[model samples]
Target: MLNIALAQLNYTVGDFSANTTAIISHMRRAAAASADIAVFSELAICGYYPGDLLEDSSFLARCDAALDEIIRTSAELPELVTVVGTARRNNGPGKPLHNSLLAIRNGQIIAEYYKQLLPTYGIFDEYRHFEPGPQTACTLSVREHRVGFMICEDGWNQPGLDYKVNPFDALKQATPELVISINASPSDIGKRKKRHSTISKACQETQLPILFVNQTGGQDQLVFDGASFAVTPDQGVVFEASQFEEDFQCIGFDAGAFMKDGLPLLASALVDLPVEEFTRRQILLGLRDYARRCGFSKVVVGSSGGIDSALTLALAAQALGAENVIAITMPSVWSSEGSVSDSVDLCKNLGIRLHTHPVADLVKQFSTGFEHSFDTPLRGLPLENLQARIRGTILMEYSNSFGALLLTTGNKSEISVGYCTLYGDTNGGLGLIGDLYKTEVYALSRHINQQAGRELIPEPIISKPPSAELAPDQKDTDSLPPYEVQDEILKWHLEGDRMPPAEAKAARNHVQGLQTSEEGRQLVARILAMVARNEYKRRQAPPLIRVRSRAFGSGRQMPLAAKY
Candidate 1:
């Protein structure tokens, strides 16, 4: 019998000592549990997706030092072997590095396996950072059984995609009885299902039990949902860890019982929950992990009584508890009574503390100073932006005084078309829903209401037409395309990277209730242009939690000053 422990931990970028301490503590606990081996997620020593930090030799030295500490401490546990991911010097020519997994037993480095495949496209620029490893597998004897090891990208083998190497193929040559894979895979819609299918197929084909460990938590724009599991030789899942939490679990494998023709069954089929529940859980996980990893306990958001802010507050309350969520409503002359009532009711429903600060006096006071200099009326864009800036200043002040992080509440659709006020509504420590479209925001809001079995978001907030209310009787449709139309264009132009003009015309023709007029085409072109122009704004914005396949940060890199 072989007892193995899987450590699914959360790591922060550039925090070397804290990460080392976490790994050592988990190893000691696993040893106390009498586990023969403990496996950690990919890049566990240094945070995964360490983007440009790999270029710093000093940072790399610190990582090496931390690894040395772990090696020295492991001498205390002679019976336990620890496997973890780290960046190692290639020792070839100039500055070559490899993403590697090191095996330590009895305080000595036993075996090392480099990553065979380095992904380059769409959210991964591994090819630009580390050299690919030779196509080989490392086999070690643990608990008298030969175990094979592989990195995250090695297991994925779909052709036509970059990094198409399959670890199982190499493992077949060694014919190891068991295999372990360390991963830092990010979360996407329906990603867990695809991962499960891949693991199940590998076990069924190789007849070797497999243990897959994944990292959990948000690192900058990337969010890792740790749903680690172990599959039996017969393809049955013997143990499954919880998603979005740091956890350690031990599984015992019976080597003698699985040589014959027996099938491993899945531990259980994934629970069929409502789509809203899944998204809610994901958002909560993203929020909680980002805050905790960054050492924050409380969050503050500017509530405009709009759907975006309402959804953000709900998710924040769920993540940090109602006590830790603070909502500040900054109302101006343009703000309606309905907006105030809705904002108050929503806060009451969520049991979160609310503060009201009318910004009319502040706006008047600031504009009074400029009244003589400007002959034009202050009722145009300047006044609208003034209101948003006042709200931003007030929210930021509270955040600084209370030592709480401020959460931005702009949806993707608004962000894509440059509908948001830079340094105004966009001022926050993190953009909670920056990747979600306006349509998705509404869907998620309805989902939340249904889950609560009561109208947590008031009916007026849902049924009423969407508006920024920056100016009197200002509706979103007045200045921009409808959300459904705008979201489709965004998906095509941004997500699909399709030609805007051609794709917009095609989309207009295919979409129901959409006008295929020249006006619509111009609208699409204008929005796309804004998305392109606002690259600098997004570059300076706070780190956003990525929930989509292609987010504005890291994955999509646009030139700061580009013509096209």
Candidate 2:
């Protein structure tokens, strides 16, 4: 009988001391649990996506030392085995390094396995630093049970989409009683569902019980949700760890059965989180990590009493306590009474401070100066944009004076076209809701109200007709398509088939409907043209927390000066 512990942990890239301390601490915890072996996620020693840092000899040396420390620490646990992930020098390979797994028992390295696949697609560039390890199965004996090993991308070959070798198949040839796979998988809209389906299918195909461990943390533009799970060939997934948080749990494996307390638990209990809850947890973790990592304790949002800023402030307050979030209401001549009053009510409900900073006088001054200097009246789109810039400048002043991180509040619908002004409302250090569509903004707003069981964000803010409030009696529909229509079109244009299957199909159908007539087709054409023209503006926008499969920054890379 062998009890295995899966340690889902968070590590900072290039911070070896912290990583080592965390690993060693977890190892001790597993020991206290009377576990025979403890497994860590991929690249647990140096953290995942070290990027070009792997190319530096000094960084590799530090990792080696960290590994050595782990090895020495394993000596004390004479009855336990430690399996960890780290990079090793490929002295006889095409690349300078190899992503490898090590098994240490009684202060000795008993077995080693190098990753067979090096993914080189979207947000991953392992091929640039590490060569492919040998295409062979690795197995080790623990308490008379044969166990197999595979890294993140190795076992993914079961899909047969990109790679040639199926690591699971190679490992199955060994016929080990259980397989252990370590991963650093990032979370997106439907990634958890995809992993469950794909890995469960692989388990059925190979007829091998598998223990999958994943890393947990927010690493700039990427958030790894450590939903480590266990699956059997007959029962699919029997157990799962926490999502979007760190976990350490031990399960006993005895006589070909996984134990919950002391007996086996059915694998039918596996289930995925609802998409809404998934998005909520992802953004919360992403924002919390970003704020902590970037050294900001307070966040400042320029709240216009609009849904965008309302949702942004709500999320920020949730992630970083209400005391840490400050709301600034910037009302203009065109701003409605509710714009200020609703913001006041919203802040009061959230228990956050609300500072009123009206920008109508500043807008008039900028307009007068522009007319005097440029020799023409500053009216139309330019004047409307001036109001946003003045509000943006005031927000920046607050940020600079008090060291609060400015948060931008534009949603995906506005970001899709050129609806937002650069350096104006876009002057945030980080954006919390840039990836959510305007339609989703309302959905999440309602969800938040439902979750709170009261009006955290005043009902007027969510129910009010959308507006920029830059001009008199203005509504967003005055210049653009309705959000219901625009967001669907934007989804079809920006994400296409990458969105969730249902959303993608609906989006395509909507676009198809819009193309049945000349007017509809012309509207689609105009929106697409605006998107093409606004690439430069998006290029300069602040980094927004990514919560979708195809976000603007790193997920979708488009040419700025290219033709439509």
Candidate 3:
């Protein structure tokens, strides 16, 4: 019988001391469990996807030292084997390093495997720093059981995939009793289901039980949902760790079947989180980690009393306690009474402090200066945008004065069409809902209210017509299509094939139906042009928590100066 301890941990990028401490603490816990092997996620030594930090010799040296420390600690627990991921110097390679894994026992490196697949696709740029390892399988004899190793992307090539070499094929030749894959997989809508299906297919094909380990944390815009799981050839997924949180648990492997408490483990079905609930948990974790990592206990959001700002403030208050979340309402002359009142009610419901800052005087000052300097009155679209900028500046002032992180509240629908002013509403340290569509913002707000069993976001804020309140009687529909129509177009235009199968099909059908008429055709063309024209604005916006497969950041890179 082989007992395997799975450590689903959260690590900060480039923080070697903290990372090492976490690894060692988990290793000690695994020892207490009397496990044969302890496994950590990919790049646990220095965190995953360090980007250009791999270029620093000092960083690489520290990574090496961290590995040495883990190895030395293993000497104390001579009977336990520890598997960890780190970067190693590659002597003969295109890149300077290799994403390597080390197996330590009794203060000695027994087995080392370099990751064969260096994914360069969306949200992954492994090829920029590390060369792909040789097409060979790495295995070791552990407690009389043969175990094989693969990194994140190695086992993804089951069949009919694009990769040139199949790492699993090499592993099949090695004929190990079990396969262990370490991953730093990021979470998105329907990603958990995709991971189980893909890995289960590979397990059945190879007829080898596999243990998949993943990390949990919010790294920039990406949040890795640590649903580390174990799969057998007969039973697809037998066990899974916690989602959106750090977890550690040990399972017994005996006679090629997983066991818990000395009995055969039953196949556990994956309970996929509802779309709105999934997005809520994802954004909460993302904001909490972003705030903690950036050294801010409090966050300030410019609450416009619209669905987007109300949702942002509610989520912020939940993530960082109510005391740590501050809402600033910057109402202008064009702002409605309901806007200020709704913000007040929302903050009261959330138990957070709300500050009202009127921006009418500030707008007048900026408008007077702009008209005097440029000999052109700041009116029409320019005047409307000035109000937004004034609000953005006031929010920033609170952020600076109170040492709080500013949260931008523009949703995907507005951002795609450039409805948001560049320096005005887009100012913030981090965007909590920038990736969510305006339609989704409402859905999640309702979900939050339902979960709380009360009007957490307030009924008026949820029922009110969407507007920027930058002009008299201005509604978002004045300049853009209704959210339901605009979101479909944005999804079809922005994400397309990257979206989940159901959503993609729905979006495609909606767009195709719209194209059947000349008016709809014109609307589609106009929205597409707006999205293309607004690329410069998105390029300058702060990073938002990514909840979908194709977020605006690194996942979708479009040239700003190009035209179709």
Candidate 4:
């Protein structure tokens, strides 16, 4: 029997000391548990997805030193073998370095395996730094069992998305008893389920029981949900780790079956989380990690008593204790009584602090200055935008004075069509709801209240119509289609086939129904024009937590000066 310990750790990008220490700690824990081999996620020594940091010689030097230390540290547990991901110089390659997996035992580097597949699509840009490794399979014999290894993207090349290799096939040719794959896979909606299906398919093709280990925690826009698992042709995901958090598990393998504590894993543990719940957990973890890593323990949100800000504040309070969340209500002349009162009730219900920072004076000052300087009264779109800008400026002042992170509250609907003012509501260090549509924002707010078992977001905040309150009685519907219709159009336009299967189909049908008439076609054209014109605005927005398959930023890139 081979006892394998999988370490799903949360690592800091480019912090070699912290990353190395974390790896060593997990190695020691696995050794103490009498594990035959301890496996870490891809790029554990220096963290995964370092982007241009990998190009720095000093960073790689630190990684080399850290790797040497880890090799020496493995000596403390003489019987345990360690497999970890790090980078090494490719002295004779197409690229300057190789993304390598190191195996160390008893203070010696036994074998080194370089990643053959460099993913360059979507949020991945591995090809920019590292060259592909050799085509040979790596296997190490331990406890009378032959184990194989593959990096994150090596085993993902299927018939549809064909790369130059099929790593599992080569590894299977070696007749290994099992395969262990380390990954730094980022999480999104339905990612865990898709990962399981892909890995299970590989197991069936190779007929090899496989152990998959992944990294956890947030790295800016990307969040890795460490839902690692063990799969076999017969059982398919027999043992699984935790999701959206750090986890470590040791499983046993004998005669092609995986057992946790010498027994089969429960079937109930293999189910997928509900997609909404998955999104909620991902956002919470992403927000917490982003704030923690950026050195801010507190967050300040401009609460407008709307669904977007209400949900953002509620999620913030939940992620980083209620005491750490501060809500600033900057009500203007156009703001309704329910706006400030609902915000007050929401803060009280959430046990968070609330401050009134009325922006009517700021709005008036900006309007007067604009009319004087330009010789034209700032009204219509410009005036509405001034109100938003005033509120944004006040919130920034709070962020500056308190040293708390400012959280932007614009949802995907507003963000897509440029409904948000550039320097106004977009003046946050980070955003919590930028990836969510207006419809999803309402759904998540309801979910939060349901989970809280009380009206934590205030009933008025949940029930009230969504508006910027920048102008008198201004509602979002006056400018854009109802969210029920606009969100479907957005899903069809922005995401296309990349959205949820059912959602994409429904959205396509809804968009077609809208396009059947001249008015519907004109509405679609208008929304498209706005989305295209707003690229400059989105480019200036701060990093937001990504929850969907096709989010803004790196997941969806658009040319600022181009027309399609």
lDDT against the true structure, each candidate: 0.82, 0.88, 0.92, 0.88
Scanning candidate 3 in windows of ten residues, the lowest lDDT window is 155-164
Comparing 1 and 2 by lDDT, which wins?
Answer: 2
Question: In lDDT terms, how accurate is model 1?
Answer: 0.82
Best by lDDT: 3
lDDT of 4 by residue, 1-564 (tens): 888888999999988888888899999999999999999989898888888998888888898899999988989999999999998889894999899988899999887899999988778889899999999899999989988888989978854266868777688789999888889999987678788888888888879988889999999999999989889898787778888889888888888888888886644556677766787898999999899889999999988888888899889988999999999998889889998889988899989999998888878888899889999998998888888887888888888999999999888989999988999999998888898988888888888888879898887777777788888888888888899989999999988887767878999999999999999999999999999999999999999899988889998889999977
| lDDT comparison, 1 vs 3, better candidate | 3
Q: Cα-based RMSD of the predictions, in order?
A: 4.0, 1.7, 0.9, 1.4
Please give, for residues 1-564, the per-residue lDDT of candidate 2 as tens digits: 789989999988888999999999998899899888899989999999898899788998999999999999999987788989999888894998889998888899998999989987666789989989887899999989999998988877776777887787778789999888989998888788778878889888998888899999888778899999988878878888999999999998866577888889686655667666777788888888888778889999998889999999999999999999999998888999989998988899999999988787888888889889999999989898888888899999999999999999988889889799998998998887888899888988888888889989888898889999999999999999889999989999988887779989999999999999999999999999999999998999988877788888877788998997
- Per-residue C-alpha lDDT of model 1 across residues 1-564, encoded as one tens digit per residue: 777788999988778899999999999998998888899988889889787799998999999999999999899998899999999888775337899999998889999998988887778888777877777879999878898999887877633254456666778899887889999988766567667777767677778777889988877667788888777655466556888778988766556222212343346566623545666777788888778877899999988888999999999998899999999998898898988888999999999899999999999988886786776557689889888888899999999899999999998888776788878999998988898888889999998888889988887888788888888899999987778778887877776632234544664453433336777667677878989888887887777777666778777888998798
Residue 41, model 4: lDDT of 89
Question: Which scores better on TM-score, 2 or 3?
Answer: 3
The residue ranges of model 3 lying beyond 4 angstroms of the native Cα positions read none
- What lDDT score goes with residue 231 in model 3? 94
Ranking by TM-score: 3, 4, 2, 1
Selected candidate, larger TM-score, 3 vs 4: 3
Superposed by TM-score, candidate 1 places the C-alpha of residue 205 at a distance from the truth, in angstroms, of 5.7
Candidate closest to the true structure, highest TM-score: 3
